[model samples]
Target: MAEIIGVIEQLWRYPVKSTGGERLDSVEVDERGLAGDRLYAVRDGSGRFGSGKNTRRFRRMDGLLRLSSRLGHRLDGPELFDPLGRPVADPDAFLRAYLQRPDVALAREDAVSHLDQLPVSVLTTATLDWVRRAAPSAVVDERRFRPNILLRTPPDTPPFVEDGWFGREARGSARSGARLTFVRASERCAMTTVAQPGLPHAPEILKAIAQAHDGRLDALAEIAMPGRLGVGDTLSLV
Candidate 1:
């Protein structure tokens, strides 16, 4: 039997790839992911997917941008905001501020006509510990695997156990509930190898997780429904 352990504390969503993300007090989850999460992404002139993945070829996407649901909408069309919360009237202008090289800028200007959207991504503390233990030397920070939900669980549990939480709803004090379904454990990628502040040596961490888990240790969960989640939310394994 699975056990109820902890509650969610922080919730985040990155509207754009590689750029910073927006923190939320509460978020509604639908099949895709946290509402307003990854609803848009920048595309290259060729209509191919573009982001930090190809930022070098499109440097203008280097600067920070944000995405959020419009006041009366359900995340079908989110709004873009600068890191300061100011509105960005022109997408081209926003791209220009971040893209530095002329060739990359024009390529982005031509290729990235709009933002790309992805399904939601979730994470938890238990998963982090598993990664830490497996790779004691790697720096595993949240930034490496940007997720929509950051759940706080018991100290010693495995990280991706939430994947086994399918058919269970994590209930909270207010009528907020999160239905968990075990998606396949996320696969590690070069992105996990990037060095960031807090995590100076990331490759080692990725290596540890991969070694411990047979080369499959990217911790992410897919949510069936999104609702308000709080610190003390009851994790009902049913």
Candidate 2:
């Protein structure tokens, strides 16, 4: 007997890999996961994926976070936005200016979703509250974790419930037939520490995740049954 664990509070789609995402009130999910998530990515002149992290010489990782990507009504169309949330005419120029890197360009990879991990990343407010208890000082915004689904768990539900959801299936609300299978706990990296829009530079956030949360903060999932998912949708273990 699967139980109603929580309601979906938010839905996020990242049109570009690792850039700011567009939050949605509702979305249609398919085998490829969210329709327009991570369909585009920054590629250097040589075609190497431009990503944050100084460790990867070919990737311009951090500055991309400063830009935000939104999907137009057409699932394939993505509009770039500046740090101030204004649509940019010359997105490439805006990116170059923000990143301070030349020869960088946005490229679309139709074959690949350009996802960092699995297709769906899920987390709960309960677990977030636990992190708040652990960190005490840092802001624990869900955006920092970049979860596609943000759930509001029932009171008394323990933190880290997602850790135990591995290999299990979860159904979305709205009677939409959506389903997802928990894959693995999402691992922490330098991206969590980098400053993004509305968030300041604070590497301590990662420290909190590592020291108290075992360096894992979210659960990655694969689509089980694709359907429309909306905010306030119930997510029940199935």
Candidate 3:
């Protein structure tokens, strides 16, 4: 039996890839990750998706990082927020103006919507705390890492413990039937080092991970058993 590790500390959903996401007190977790997570993305003129990972195709990947989005509870599509935190009624118009590239348009996620390695990404506060030691001044917002679930480990847990979570089976609420099979360690990328709204430029973040943790910060997981998840749900590392 896996020990009762921790309860989820934070939940996040990225309506658009590479763009900032919305924080939630609770969320319905599904096999495809979170509901409406990475559901929308900005496509460039060539019909290629915009992502910080694919800078060659979308040279303005970092540009997309400036904006943020949340689900439109009352609207059919996502509600966008500009750099200054002002609501943008028109995302395409905002993208065109913000990116200064009229050729770009917002595209919803399909088969190609998965820009990352796994469906769900998991991280622990202990790991983040461990990472903070590398550069104390830089902002270490969980948003920068873009994880689906942020589990709060025990107060006594050591930092970077999530690295050991790899290749493990994590069980959640029995009603929700959630069990995540940790596939592999999520390697840090350039996106983590970028300076965004609340985060200052911290290039050393990646260097710290590479040097201190072998460039691994989180774990990518696949749903072994589908179930609902919410804040405060106890997760067992089986």
Name the candidate that leads on lDDT: 2
**By TM-score, highest first, what's the ranking?**
2, 3, 1
- Candidate 1 at residue 58, lDDT? 36
Q: Rank the candidates by lDDT, best first.
A: 2, 3, 1
Q: What is the lDDT of residue 238 in candidate 1?
A: 45
Model 1: CA > 4 A from native? 52-91, 100-118, 133-137, 166-174, 196-201, 218-226
RMSD values for the candidates in order, in angstroms, are 5.9, 1.9, 2.0
Instruction: Give each model a TM-score.
Output: 0.67, 0.93, 0.92
Pairs of residues at least 3 apart in sequence or in different chains that clash in candidate 2: 51-60, 51-61, 52-61, 52-62
Error of 1 at 125 (Å): 1.4
How many residue pairs clash in each candidate at the backbone level?
Answer: 17, 4, 1
Tens digits of per-residue lDDT for model 1, 1-238: 5456567667776554455566777766766666655445555454444454453333233333232223223444445565556666765455655554222221222333332223544467878767767766676666667766667777777666756654444444448755655445566665566544344546676667667675554334456565656444655554
- lDDT of prediction 2: 0.82
Clashes of 2: 4
RMSD of 3: 2.0
**For candidate 3, lDDT tens digit of each residue in 5-53?**
8888988888888888888876666778777788888888786777877
Q: Give the per-residue lDDT of model 2 (tens digit) for 27-94.
A: 99999888888888887776667666532323656677888899856665679988788999987887
lDDT of 2 at 36: 87
What value does the lDDT take at residue 205 in candidate 3? Answer: 83
**Consecutive 10-residue window with the lowest summed lDDT within model 3:** 54-63
